[model samples]
Target: MLLQLCLLYVTIWLHSVSAQSSSIAKPGCLERCGTQPVPYPFGVGPGCSMERSFEINCNTSFNPPRAFLSILGGEIMGINPTNVRVNMPNLALSTYGQGARILTVVYGLSTTRYTFSDQNWLTAIGCDDMAAVTGLANRSFSGGCVSYCQSAGDSGGVASCPNDSNGFGLGTGCCRTPIPKGTTNLFVNLTDVHRNWRNNKLFSTSYAFVGEMVTSNFSYRLNDLNNATIFLSDNWSAKNTPPVVLDWKIGQQNCDEARRNLTTYACKANSECVNFDTNIVGYLCNCSKGYQGNPYLDPGCQDSDECADNPCDPNADCTNIPGSFICKCRKSYGGDGMKGGSGCTKLPPSTIINVSIDIDYTWASGKTEISSPSDTRPFISDIV
Candidate 1:
């Protein structure tokens, strides 16, 4: 019985997946590079992508192969419709002197369909280190954080050092600040806070970089801080560098402006245009409500039959409409008929009746007296 139930669930899931419309690349375009799925608007070669800036290069030199952005020139670690995760280099400051060093990360995404997402945070990791990060993409933005010397066992300050494997930036040996939206070009400056900390062996190397909040992994360890060889090794570099998320859109114009030229508009039939809320001007296409498919392709998004999901009450009838569904009560029933609303109720019988009657009463005052004839009238009924 359990095996049968599991099989039934799998069959239902497969049917549901097959019913949904596809969002794939053009007929002749390459849809994937290595293991990365190069969906429509993003392709592997010429004539594959919607634009030149969306092109991706598949590097086969690696063991399992890797995908990189052709225009921006960064290894593509992960990708979705709205965001792309890339392997960003870290800003390392290695010196004994109590001085500051500046490192600039110029992504040069001004001419591309990409921008920095606000999901990233500017983080600095080291004892006795102060780091500031600035951006110059759509506007001028800056934020900084400071970290003090704190061991894994120390809990002296209000915010203690991260003792767990998952190191959280809490101002002790590590600190992090949020970066503003639409930041492509980044500048980071790392400064050694105290001169006396330079003499200490534990405070050797400092690291700073802009990394996505969810994927970054910079753990706190006293042994890692003391050893310079392990901190600067290739194995450490691969594990320490954080993934940066980049937001991509269809074009550099608003939905209204892009709609003026129908030939160049990205949104097709059965789809709507959504403008970006950032300082940059761009738009994205989405399938209309109750529809699923690629909005950028011909024949556009396909309407989904919501009634197939049995969204209506068991006693109600569900009708599939264009991009929507309607639910109504069955014959001899009334009410909204939806499962969430007042479900179908039985209607009253189609019949009417009326009746009239006369009554008499006697008054008793010392002796029984009969009621007046005019007072004894027929009473009409209200029910029908």
Candidate 2:
């Protein structure tokens, strides 16, 4: 009865696998979203991606083409299943040495799965500029790092440092701070923050944006604004901010809860759902140990041939499984027979064969005996 039940379960599992829909973008469908290669789990146009959440817009009107996030207004630089990097809009408001102009930049986040990464730093530029960046990191957290020059001369100065030096100009003139996790929404306020530091003439020109970590050397000269490129010198433009990282996930619920529903469950066969381990939201789907490729695709993750690495000893046999591999000892060996373990060891030298004979030696009565299979053939009695 138990055996029958096991067979039924196997049949059901196989059926479930066959029923999974194929959503991964294959040939004929739109593959290149702008300059970026939209892999499975993320795609361009309809029916080409895992879902609408992963849809990307390929704007072809541009000369070289460009990919844009459907919800966010930024050029997509690269997209992986787990993380994304983009150059966000460098929305800015500068006086241009004119009247006092205040620029407020607001970035709208559509879902809970993505958040500005800690890998980015909120940076502010300009000598007499004051700026503050605030965001909703699951709460109303305000007051990020502020940037303002201590004095006009402080903004520009000659410097020299070792070529091997690796560090950022945190407090010298421009200021930088970290963005909190779970922050979906972002607002940059160039309000009264920079008012006090402004001079009567074209004194305070400021800019603020989120970008990757900043590093510099002592060769920099602060007084020469044109020479400073790391933070100052007005290098950022309205169309681009420094490279920023974005986190991504696969499912709405925890790993266990998503596993119950086969229809809407994101992970395909031979894949495992992993819950988010950080303050970032949502769960990720990954191929099992010995598999590779998009776990969200039909037929599930593809098998990775681990035996190609010659993982087993020469005397042992290695069998590649769907998501794993196995090793076994050879015919006349005894040991784990693994690649790194004690390999197939030879058997002992002694050969004391035991024999068993079964026959009707007395013409009427026949009896059976048991012994080694190799020795029984040699023990047969001759007809007397």
Candidate 3:
């Protein structure tokens, strides 16, 4: 009977707690842009978002509503309230530097540039190929990769170009280099395009690009040169590009800097403003650990229910508090009863043990004596 009552109480507590902290969008603003959950600080229309940069345009022309970024043009996949993600636009660039014009894929350096995620790899794919991907790096912004292989067979010179189960003449040859933090723009340039191997020289074409880890074939045989066998993941040859993962924010200043500007400061009650570690620039707002929802709305940060998962033992009581919960042991039990904590157990009763005692007698003097075999130990306070 007690267990039933406890469970009922917990259910009510969870519901009430949630009701007090429901996530709310701006007044009269659409909570959703197409099918996407338009969380606060980010909205589809004016007066809905925290700033101009946070605006998302909902295109209803498609079968389902599709959201696109006005500043960073790309189709929206989905947005997580806790951890936000956006896809940066992708473009494949391929051209040979015959004598001077060495060109390849590039991402930023425009009026509107994306912070190329550090996760994206700057890759070079070819035999006798050296590619450089320049961005923000080591006080400046520059990095790259280099690969070399024989035109046909084994001719030991530099590094060995190992092949897998994928047949010969198929140069799955690849070289990798890491993209660092604060990459505002990425420029991929194919260097050493024309190099002599033997009779089979590499005056042809090689590939270099900065993108995600997805592969496809690029048959590089432009005009009379032919002979462009390179395997690059992220499918540089396909016109339909994969989504580029990008971390976005409302402004370029850190939390303290944003707060100083009252008119522009966006985080609401119980919300926290965080600065981007990638660069000392952009910032993001989030509800505090115990809360959830749009931190830009009034009373925006809502309380989270920790008891929804039945975290406490049946012999304990669950109490929902602001930003946290408490699990208390019942009258008949002891110890913390919450999940991961020492659960409630049968209570311990009075305990006694045999021991020696030193005492002063008013009838005589003082004497040290051993306790009787059956004598119960004295109360701690009564001793001495």
What are the clash counts of all predictions, listed in order?
Answer: 0, 4, 2
Off by over 4 Å in 2: 1-27, 61-64, 111-113, 148-169, 191-203, 214-240, 277-281, 312-317, 327-384
Query: What does candidate 3's lDDT look like per residue over 1-384, in tens digits?
Result: 999999999999989756545645576776776678777766787777777666788888987877886666666666654333455533232334444333666676334323555545655555566677777543456766565554433243222222222212233334656576556667777666434444444434555556543445433322212233232233444442335555565666788888998778878788888886644465777889878766877766887787886889888999889998899989879988876888899887858986655442332335555555565555454444
Query: lDDT value for candidate 2?
Result: 0.63
Better of 1 and 2 by lDDT: 1
Model 1 steric clash pairs: none
Stretches of candidate 3 off by over 4 Å are: 1-25, 33-35, 80-92, 95-102, 109-114, 147-171, 192-206, 213-241, 349-384
Ten-residue stretch with the least lDDT total in model 1: 157-166
Q: After the best TM-score superposition of candidate 2, give how far the Cα of residue 52 lies from its true spot, in angstroms.
A: 3.5
Candidate 2 local lDDT, 281-313, one digit each (tens): 468888889887668767778777888888887
Q: For candidate 1, lDDT tens digit of each residue in 1-384?
A: 999999999999978655444647777776677788877787888888899888888888986778888887778888786889987666646454544444444445677777788777777767777778777766788778777764434444232233222334454677777776777677787777766555553466677777777533345564465455676677776786667889888877999999999999999889999997646788999989998778888768988899999888888999999899999998999998888889889999888765433343333333433445555444333112
Ranking by TM-score: 1, 3, 2
**Candidate numbers, best lDDT first, in rank order:** 1, 2, 3
Q: Rate the local accuracy (lDDT) of all candidates.
A: 0.73, 0.63, 0.60
TM-score, per-candidate, Cα-based:
0.75, 0.67, 0.67
| Residue 237 CA displacement from its true place in model 3, Å | 6.8
